[model samples]
Target: MLNNMLVKKAFRIIRRNYGCPGLDGVSIKDIKQNYNYYINKIIDLYNSYTFGRYPVKTTTITDYNNKPRDIFIYCLYDRWIQQILKLQIEEIIENDLKEYVFGYRRKLNIGMLRKYTKSFNSKYILNIDILGFYNHINRDHLNKVLIKNTSISKEFLTRIDLSFSHLSNGLPQGNVLSPILSNYYLAGIDSMFNSKYARFSDDMFFAINDLEEQNDIINKLVPELGKLSLSINFEKVRLFETNSFK
Candidate 1:
């Protein structure tokens, strides 16, 4: 019914504009034979309705109010990474430590503190994934890991490994054991800092002295990220030096 209505409208326009049976220097016979032109016009209109919009607005970490990215990150941290970190911290406290033997000399205390710190460090990779959280398959008792139908190619994944030197280089994204590769690149920034920091997706705010270090890390990581089939925006990276942070 809709097709008929559209065809009728097209014919009406052709007839009204060229009642004498010739239009745009073509005869009525030629106009009638121009089926391809009319068909193409209709297909173009259909495409405008389909490819022009999506139900979920897709965006990146830097973009705000884009529901998909926002929801994904929120689910990642609040539901997954946070809990994992809590458990890991508990494990580190429980399994990796021995009773302190401290009531002795200054040199002995310093050496013991260093040994404990290094032991904890050995149990952890110096990196984290920014979007380390994985959603569950469903809100059910089975508790399967959530999967995204990512289009990343196998070749791209291989190249990302090569780029990060098998995750031995670059800053961490957030969760060390998180499956997402992007996290390692982002989380390693803390390696340069002498204190803690916070992050909002890719937007990072850190100590001034550490800003150059962060920039250098990001700069180095950006080129290698093409291995993962990802790109970074240099223009949007903001560097601020402030005395406000305690």
Candidate 2:
């Protein structure tokens, strides 16, 4: 159950951050003006175990190359709820996550991956990236992962299901909690492979000694990923020999 203290802490985090309005156009200023009322409302919904819907606003921003890119904005209230859940969920699964995963973890980045690569004496590296990673995550697979990894309540599971049902397919991109969820969802892949593997978001690197081993790993991995409704972007898949690494 979400308590007042947790709600308040979540509110503080949301209040400190600057964010655009949701599809409903409820601005941060508006939320600040009626902070207590909104917070209480959110608590009431959470306490009652009711699932609430939030709008996702889509807007285009001009890139440095003068290209327009669409960015989705989630509601502040929704973000506050996510913040609370993220804290609890991460606390439960953080230690269980593999060391190879560097995405979304504190103080872990490409540098760690580089150092890890240096330990590998393999001359062949297989690089794979999942296309539309966030948009392609299987909801059923994610639910199973949460269930297996945590002891969340049935009511809480219902609430989670209700929340995700709004997203027809894949996890929502740009949400604070999505990356953590993505990492957890892919944990199975990490456990299945014995090779020197590293991941940053959906980008995966595998160190193998030869082409035969690379093919063997691919054969084992493809079906596993398929069970979760994930696939590699073959066009982006690269296998190259690096004599310098050996």
Candidate 3:
């Protein structure tokens, strides 16, 4: 059943888009063996540039010999982020381990878009517009604040309770860190898999060289997120081996 879902062009497009200098020699079977080294190097590069002040884009360039440097630095930062993603794909190819899968529950689902984009043969395809969605929710939160502030204190208390009741189901208030933490985990999966090959919304795929490593990731993630009320549906979890193993 899953075999029919495979879009052969997805791999071709990924190779075309992210196939870079260091990616030249990697293969699908050796990804895991090389992932840690690549990720460490990426972390080193990010830490080096991201220290002191966050990279920003504006008409400010008093640093680096007084030449306009902020925009160039910002672009460079983005380039490194992209290169790190490419290396992750190479890592996936080099490793031969059991495949891991995850099922996600979220307010929105983009399963159809995932299907459609895969069918379209695009180089970089992501169904959900995560950035746009975040902006929309933040605007809504701002509106709620305006409504609360414009009202009388007694009525404001009642409206605040009602507003928060609705907001919790959307994105929890006073939790800007929640979004960062969620993105961190999501990004970590991409780093782990070294591929946009990981599915969104309903599923995630992890291919590791060792079965034990796969279990280790699950153990780490489950406890890390346990206090946050994040959950997993174990019934949907399945184990499969490539036909090459048999």
Candidates in order, TM-scores: namely 0.24, 0.84, 0.26
By summed lDDT, which 10 consecutive residues of candidate 1 come out lowest?
A: 136-145
Query: What would you estimate as the lDDT of candidate 1?
Result: 0.32
| Candidate 3 weakest lDDT stretch, 10 residues | 1-10
Q: Give the residue spans of candidate 2 off by over 4 A.
A: 59-71, 240-246
lDDT score, candidate 3, position 112:
38
Question: Could you tell me how far off, in angstroms, the CA of residue 154 lies in candidate 1 after the best superposition?
Answer: 17
Residues 14-54 of candidate 3 have per-residue lDDT tens digits of 33543222312444334346644544543553434331122
Best-performing candidate as measured by TM-score: 2
State which candidate has the highest lDDT.
Answer: 2
Residue range 159-207, candidate 2, lDDT tens digits: 6665554577788655667878899888889888655888877878888
User: How accurate locally is residue 149 in candidate 2, as Cα lDDT from 0 to 100?
Assistant: 51
Better of 1 and 2 by TM-score: 2
Candidate 1 residue lDDT tens string, 1-246: 124344444444444533222112444355458855744543443323221111211223432313233221121111122222223233322232223322111243433433433333222212212222223111111111111213433333332332222224332222222322222323333234323233333333333345456666566555544433345555444443332221
> Which residue pairs in candidate 2 collide?
none
Q: TM-score of model 2 relative to the true fold?
A: 0.84
Question: Which is the better candidate, 2 or 3, if ranked by TM-score?
Answer: 2
